[model samples]
Target: MEKTREWVITGADGLDDLLVDELLALGGSEPRRLKGAIAVQGDLAAGYRFCLWSRLASRVLMPLLTVPSGNPDRMFDDALKYPWEQVLRPGATFVIRSAAAKGVSTHTHFAALRLKDAIVDRFRQRTGDRPSIDTENPDLSLHLFIEAQQLTISLDFSGDSLHKRGYRLAQTDAPLKENLASAMLMQAGWPARGEGRLFDPLCGSGTVLIEAALMWADAAPGLPRIHFGFDGWAGHQAELWKTIRDDAVARRLAGLQRPAPRLVGFDADGEALACAHRNAESAGVSQWITLSQRSIAEWRAPALNSVAACLPAEWAADVTGAGQNYSVPGLVATNPPYGERLGDEGSVRYLYRAIGRQLRETLPCWDAVVLAADITHADALGLEHKHTLRLYNGALPIFARHGRILPAEPELPLAFEGSLDDLPEEGMDFANRLQKNLKVSLKLAQQQDVRCFRLYDADLQEYNIAIDVYEGRLQVQEYAPPKTVDPAKAEARFKLALQIIRKVMGLHRDKVFLKVRERQSGKQQYEKQGKAGKFFEVREGQATLLVNLTDYLDTGLFLDHRPMRLRIAAEAAGKHFLNLFAYTGTVSVHAALGDGIHGGAETTTTVDMSATYLGWADRNLALNGLPDSHHRLIQADVMAWLKDERDLYDLIFVDPPTFSNSKRMDSDFDVQRDHGHLLRLSMSRLAPGGTLYFSNNFRKFVLDEALQAKFDVTDISAETIGFDYERDPKIHRCWRFRHRV
Candidate 1:
């Protein structure tokens, strides 16, 4: 019997226990777990078996010696004491990799350089030949590490981290590492206890399915490798390794004689599926696996009677055990992209919810495991899990857990009523209206050089949604239905309408922002719906405005009032401008910067109640190259500011919400009830022959007859409405009021 050799196997953090189990199963003894590595005693054949069978380990290192190290000088002397010519031939190329804890050897690159110097000097003295360093591919790969002033040197037996697997010739957008996929499969109990079936719905590059196929065929992951780091070492025994590999080949041939496990992969991206086929072919497991192109929502479990119908005729075998009467559902394992790497959190949540519902309805008996980068993302799946296996993929921390797919109970049914394959009636009507409206609005926008406008404004009552286009991005707002409407039906209609809009407009998932518009009271209008704080620039006439689509219910720029801002810009020149209830100060920015305002306005003052809106106004003003000395921002109640103002303005723009009860205000203000008092106070500060453009979004707003009698009032609401918004006459009401001189 051969003597046992001490070995250390290193892998990603948090999978130490799994690595230990893998080593112990391959005839290793006295297996011990370290922080992120494992130590075991095994013979030469045992070591060779681990190098060939390990799927989770990154590298297998054979420690030659340990030396006490302090500074660079001592480390160099210690490295030179080891025999280098024996490990490598006279002219064989080599490379030294280094890692150090925060101590005397702080820099990894400097340590690596010192080790190389010592090895090269020793080789020159012994054989009179200095070995050349090959960074890309080396005959001998040396690993050097220093921790707590102790340095240990080892020879890397399995080069390139052992995770490459050498079969993945192509990659998708964010492909998972092969080893991490294998770890997930092991945690799910694949090929152990007669594992039957395997599936990956979102398989990109087919890493998970390919790894499972290898395990099912009883083939080693490294069987296809033509070279390893130990090939050139003098201590390597060639015949011992050949025996181990020959045994693996014979086991693989024997496993092939029996029925192959049903391994399948599906991806919505056809290119990804094609890549999976190429990868499976390279891995020599193409015959045992099947690939298809379909979305997650479209996936359905195979019928129990014909479970293996999708596979080739020669590979189709009984999906059930010999004594079992029915076929069992396969294990589902997938590594779906997280929010940070793929799309937004909301989209990923929607995807996970769809996946969970599909699993519950179709494959309730199947065991599932999903690997997610975030705990929040995993919770979005809406499935209960037994436990999570925490692991690391490169630098990203991940959670791999067993997911429970419960059967749909008769008492409690799923919320989804219909499939999302096509648009419903309400959605179809909404899409047609948007297409018709966009044709005219787009032409009008191009003629006027406008980059933002309303494309659809609740044309279909059943789908109470408004679609606005800013540049190429779309912002959709769904109006809260009345109490008479069904909540579930309303949600279904809203989702379908959004789908239609996205398809018709060719918008990516991230390009469309959705919000719900409800009757807001108090500070609800100013509250944030999301914290993304994403802003995009849109052009209205000459000035640019920054509008946030994801943060709040209402974007900073109101599309219906685009014409009014342009009108204000056209009329103001060499005049003092006042914008009360300024919101984002879009009109002020236009007035201060537009070319129509010759010599520009002397100075502009913008007043709003919310500090957030005030800050947004400041950014808008700065975006258009407007000087602060020429533009001012004030956080105050518009009514109170009107009372204290002593100076008269040449032009004024007042556009207030329908209702507000802000904490900063002395009392709640209603536009319908307070218009009389608001107009009376605002006209007092108006200069002689000055015009005040008053606009309100209240659909039922009525001008006070008493105030109209006192001031020169012209209902120019018709003139303010642009061609795009003419369909909704009551979108906003505007009037030009001046003191009767």
Candidate 2:
């Protein structure tokens, strides 16, 4: 709407150069570095474009005028000299935000008030009335920056901080502002890495990876935002802005079509990873990110496979090739837990040490960037950085250290890390029971055509663990012993159980993955004892699904649900099926597959809270020749989703966790307490004569008798339990329900 005008762009202090580069690249020129900001000259369109394209700027300001400050009275009179009628319309609302230097006014409030009064008085004098002051959501936002006896009044082009980006709907504790995270990646030479993975090992909520993905995709950071400060300004160019916005959309589409580099993130905290998944999806980059709940201790290269599978079909070969061994050259940029945030110095040191070891021992030939709280904590990494730039996360000064990972050294495998002597006892009585159980379980599994089954589930209480066989690999899960049992004794027994498995099963260490199951307080399906893993395809009955033995406590496929899936396939012909709290959509796929008995289902809707699981569910459905048109995957809390759901389904499968409390959800859920309400909601959407299959892993779960009175109900746990899972009949409970006549 106007010719070139002076604009100041503010960002994190240490990243001014990056902001300057962005300004020049976005139709601005002659950028001059200022304290905490950069000054540039640009037309009105450039100001709006920077708001959309700049990933590291906090605010963009267009200075209306600069005048020297005398006393308060004289400064107010000078402020009135600006033509108020041109800047403000009669009865329009505006707000003034200001910061003043000591030389300008000792009282910042007094300075701001004087400026505010001058604007109002000028409007009143020029016209018949003054504009109203709307502090929140004002039509116009004026900013005053005063220093060295000079005041520069400007309009804040960004109504809100540019760091909002409108993507982070969920977050973890001590999150870095979006702009600061972008600055960190820029300092580390990210999108510039050109072709390698961008990994964040301790990616709390995935701010860094999300920013990196959005930038790489050429998606304007502010493209999704509805409003800007300039929208209400007199000079906003609606047509020019529309043209720029349309071009940005086209650029994003082209960028998405190109092959995207692998982006991966991992965290020990399941809640944080869940937040990250939703954040990436909100940012439209979930398809470009691989997120898993994994401990840093399990971090190692060659084991980290690329999980982002949404790419051009032609490029799948290259992506898969690089993922097989993680041989792609990349940058490891992460902000790990440090003392100030974590408070425990010892734990912080331990985290940093583990990070350093992984970088040096596993990620050879890769460059690394880490943001740490201070030098003391940073040094704990035991890495020699090539450069360290001082910066601030909000107000806390931090350091971004860049270094090249030391070439990996040759390693010798340990015999179970620390071989427990005197535990196996050659022929322990418990070992004998496990051997017998395994033989029976294997025989039953073979006869039933089960590739993955629970072989031994604490058959003997002394060795309290479950050994599962997935194709040929074995995953031994040690269920945490009750507190009444001695810790040392349990540890000894677990070690002995492993030794016996090696001898009896004749499997090497490489073929076995270990997970320790502990009673959890969060979503246990998401929160698992399993470590990071490379997922592989597994054929179960008529459909192929992906599973990872080391990824989570529950393999993406629930072996216990085999009979239920068979039931779904038999009953799903021509019926619209709904699977609520669907973990990996195995049930939905079975419904779509139709089990050689019924025709394929008419439609299927799978709902789950975790975006990670939903992604897997989609791949499962697609693998089984199901199209997205008829098979829809919805990511939402089932409880909340049910209220707005109106479609009626002929066959409904409802399975929920015993207890769950997610930031993505409205409230915490207890299956026993909420089942009645949950079941009633599910029943509302059931078509006449439709059947609902409800199940849960909570051992003590009892179906509410009231549901029986309201709807026809039958206990089907016995029928759904396959031969392999018959031993632990109480492992899970199942039921069948229908509307009463």
Candidate 3:
């Protein structure tokens, strides 16, 4: 027997055990699993066998040497030790691929250059002729792994990834790699469960379907691939390679001559089906597979001929266990889309539920493998999973859940009727509740011609979300639910609510924005919620304010403060106005542009810490035709600005955050803890007979005793709570304070 060399086979993460089993099943021995790579001792023939036969491998590596290498000189000397003439001819082109430990200086790209330079220099010094470098189609491909102060150089036996079998002509946005798709089928017991049907109803570009066809025909994954890294290597065995290739072709032809399995693929996209056909043709498995343009939602399993026709003798009994006499046993495996947006949750859940229903109504007792990013989606299938395999598709962590589709039950209702207004039963209850709430506010909103207001504030206990309308657009903020509730269920309800709101209001998808509201600390409230900087002008009585529904948690204008802004406009005539913590300066804009029923403000000063909001304030003033010269927009901490103010103002509004720990602040500010100091400072700047208005949304706010004694304080929270916000009195709280002269 020829001496064996140590070989490492690498694959995607979460598939190391499978790859190790594959290597051992091949002619490799002493298989040991490392991180994402499996090490095995194998002869050169065994390496070539794995390159051709192993379906789960990403790359096959033959280790040449290991050397201690942290310093640049040590790395160069270690790489130079290899005999360049043996690995490559004088003019042969090569490329190096590298990976390194966390703190290494030259990790991948730079490390490859260093190793290549050493190889080139060694050849130059020995024969005065160096091999050229080729990155695209290198004759010799080298792999280096640098960990701590050690570097291990290996010869790559697989040119490109084994998954790239020269079959994929087109793909969708997130196609599963071919090798991973094969692993999924193996995990589901494909050919081993012989004579059983295979289906991928959501097949995108048909990678999964084509792999299934190959499995049905006993075809090697690499049989169609024309190139391997060992083709031009020094140890190339052309005759032995040709023999192995010939054997694979003979086996494929023999398998195709036998009765093929019922392998079928269905996709709603016509172009995707066409692409799948092209790929299957290129793979030479087109005759073994069938592709169709149809959605899984309308899919029903074909009827079985007799009890004997049911797959795997136990399936008939299992389907009979669900109180159904007839049974169809097969496999349904698919990689469904992982929706990354809140709006996408509804559709994803609907698809999963539809699959579960089709399996129950049509193909009960069948085994299934569903690859989904969120485990909640698998759970949404309304099936009891036998087990789950964790896997990685690119950088995303996904789960391949294997389960038996059970009989339909009321426990997990399939509520996907395909429309927002016609949501499933549970979702309908919430949508109807929103409809009722909208009815209560629609009349009042139309009478006043109000453009923006809160339509729903968690009207139903189960749906923990708030829906607000800004002119024609809608913004939804879902309050983080307690741990007692299932997150997936909560998310599903939120998605359903958004869709219903859009349909009810006839709003475009782009006009709706959804955000998950979590508990905030520090100045996170001022952070930008999204990258869309779109702002639209909405009417508020006589004033026009700019509002952004997509960029932040709170729109530019506070709808609950509509009545309050009107109050300020009534009393701000001929008065010098001061707005503190002036978010967007809506009140100051009203004061500056008052109708002069009494008189308008002589001058207005709007102070806030956010430059973005200050810029917004300037825009609001300009929109309302208020001149910038009379209005001063000061960007500073309200507390710091209050300390420096000596001028007197007739009217002032101080509405600070309930709690603020902004990084720019010298110290944290809590309305309850520091209200006395804040009030005293602002009151000192007020004229003798001037009144101050203070408000906050702190549900449990309490006025300070010292400040109450220092001035005549009147709680006007009841009067300030407007009609639109009358349902929730604590939406905002306001007070009137007159200085004791």
Candidate 4:
């Protein structure tokens, strides 16, 4: 009988199509989409080739046999009867993993353990010595999928999940999975070949940019991975794997275009930038990227012509391949911060508003694709939305807003012709101060050449304010009242306020749009409302840090941590970093990129208890170039992992919540009460002389008296926090620790 081989590729949610297309492009048979998976028919050699080259696949499994069984014992018996000698060598290390969908089995682990016993018994009965189970790093991996009593046992031809594309050496909190990163880049419509800059403004570990560099160079995303299940399979084809690798290498060499466009990342954290640079180095593309440590406000685009001139000759040829001059236009793409799981509603809104402002002002001609949950935020950019593609970063439904800046609208006279006394007696002072603040902010933004600035006064009553700053213009409006008697009336009142501000500044009425939203009770309530509001009015040329202060506790910016995220991406090349208490894992993604010169591929691991936050972290990782294999997301308590696992990491981020009950670990974690213990435990897992970044948002968190005795601790809070944090300068405290031992 002719041998028939089947392969499966796993991916993030909604990525089955990309994986299928990738497989077909590689000459595999038509791929069939399954839940979170893609199946294809090919020869063993083709399967191995797929394992080695696929970028969007998480794992490539080769089915060895399928058996029908009604019970666990029968399933084991059928699995044991397989030709074990053909697949497993005597005394080799192996592991069994099982997944049971509905109608198949209820206990997945139990099913997996049974299969393991069967495989071992088969080996032992024949050879008297059995392959030992090596779960962490198995020589051979077997995957069993049971669906409705139909058992499918396959050898994980891609060994470690295809997501682990061997380039990463360190990790941080909630890093993006490698495959998901690739998928996200694909979804973002990242140009396959372009000299235009690809940026991850909130790059946690440099996953998005690194992936873009790799894809841009036609480098196989899995080139750095060391092992594959095909390496040990009975029909393993070393020659084919070699051919695939060699072909990939040859393509990379031939595709080497000169003066690649600046693949840049910005994060505020120095450690994160260091890690990103290190990661880029590991990925072997550090030379193709640029890393910067600056807040979004400080970020300056490279000269347009300079960036355009950096395009390789070949890219010009390829663009001309379609008979068009290859003048690669600059494009700004990023996974901006959202309030979900990463920051409070206030911080997320502030972040979105800031991003909108930056795109509108500094990158007017440049195209931008922003992956955000609330698509309405795109209106804040003062740009016309050309298209919006729907995608899910895990379960968070997001819209990829793609557009270029629209021409400036003609100015109109203020709609209101009334004096301050015309306003309600209760709101007269608030309105006057708000108008004054808007004027001051607009002037400051223009003076600083800020394309988009925010003017907000959270403390103001009746007229809490937010303004959008644009070139030669300002858009001012009142935040929605805390509890509105009539939202329509309140909105009208806000419009009047805007007109008053416009008239005061002698600006056109078309330059400003007033927005009002009723404040809700809690964070979830606010998120629902924010999502419901779709788009809020964006003030042009406002100088404050946040655009929408009253939408939630946080406006659209987290100005304080902007520097930290930028720094992490700058330095994350070719290093493995860990992010603990990675709320949204923004820093972890930044550190995955090496310094752009070498385009490093660092690995990152993000840990958090909230699945909601982890989902956001995963999206951040995907938005960057980090692959699933290069990053790990653990929905477990950090303290428990410190106690249970002995894995040593190069960079460790220990940013813990102030206090919380962690249902995942079944314990109450108080950073103040237990930070010393937590820090000690995390440090114990750090690689020798590795750096441990410990931070807490608690303003009152006191350092443990004993911590200084064992390690070097430096207070980096001042450097890490940017200019936006107001209430208490010490809202969060960060310390860098280096092990003495």
What's the lDDT for all of these models? 0.78, 0.78, 0.77, 0.63
Candidate 1: 10-residue stretch with minimal lDDT: 411-420
Residue 407 miss distance in model 4 (angstroms): 6.2
What TM-score, over all chains together, does every model reach? Answer: 0.57, 0.53, 0.54, 0.56
Candidate 3 lDDT, 1-741, residue by residue in tens: 667989999888888777877888888999888767899998877888899988889999888878886666787887888786787755778888888765766646777788889999889889998788888988889888988767888888888899898889887767889888988888878877634477777788899888888887878888878789887588787888888889988998898887867667777567878888888888887876677655442243332322322222333324566545544467888886655421224335444655676667666677788887778878867766777778888888888888777865433211112234455665677767776667767767777666678888886887778888776667788999999889888777777777777766566788788878788767878989898877776767656678887778678888888888888988888799999999989999888766434545878999999887887787676544353446788989889989988999999999999889887776899998888889899999899889899999888888888888879999998888766788898998898999876
lDDT of 4 by residue, 1-741 (tens): 325567787766666666778898876896787876888888766776687778877788878788775578787888789778889765578888888765554677887888888888888888788678888887788898878747788888888777777777665565666666676666546664234566566665777778788878778776776677766666665676788789988887765574575677776556667878888899888888777654453342332224432322221111222223344345566665544535334334445655765554344444566666675655545545666665565567666666654323434422223245455555566557756655565464446333444445453544556554443445454555655457887676566656556644455765554444444332242142233222233222212321333333333433345556555555555667888877666666556643333333357888877675666566454433234545788887788777897778887777765667644555777788888889889988888867887777676778997998878888888887543344336757878899775
Runs of candidate 4 with Cα error greater than 4 angstroms are 1-4, 102-105, 257-259, 300-328, 373-542, 545-741
Cα displacement (Å) at residue 638, model 3:
41
lDDT of 1 by residue, 612-729 (tens): 8887887676555454545788899999988898989889998988999999998899999998898888888788989999999998899999988999999989988887788887
Model 2 alpha-carbon miss at residue 126, Å: 1.9
Off by over 4 Å in 1: 102-105, 193-195, 300-328, 411-741
Candidate 2 per-residue C-alpha lDDT over 1-741 given as tens digits, one digit per residue, 9 for 90 to 100 = 478888899888688777888789999998898878999999878988988889888999988877776567877888888886776655668888988654444666777899899998887787868788899888888898878767788888887889899989999989988887877777767777636477787789999899888878888999988778887788677899999999999999998887876887877677888999999999888998888755453344434443332222222222222114443367778887655554224335435655776676555556678888778667756654677878888888888887766654443221121222344465467666766776777677667677777788877767778887777678898998999999998887788778888767777888888888877766666754545747665666666677878877677877788899988888998899999999888899888767644455778999999977887786666444354546788999999999999999999999998998988899999999999999999999999989999999999888899999999999989999988788778878999999998
Which ranges of candidate 3 are over 4 A from the true structure? 102-105, 300-318, 322-328, 340-347, 410-741
Q: Which ten residues in a row have the lowest lDDT in candidate 4?
A: 314-323
Question: What count of clashes does model 2 give?
Answer: 0
lDDT of 1 at 668: 91
Q: What local lDDT does model 3 show for residue 690?
A: 93
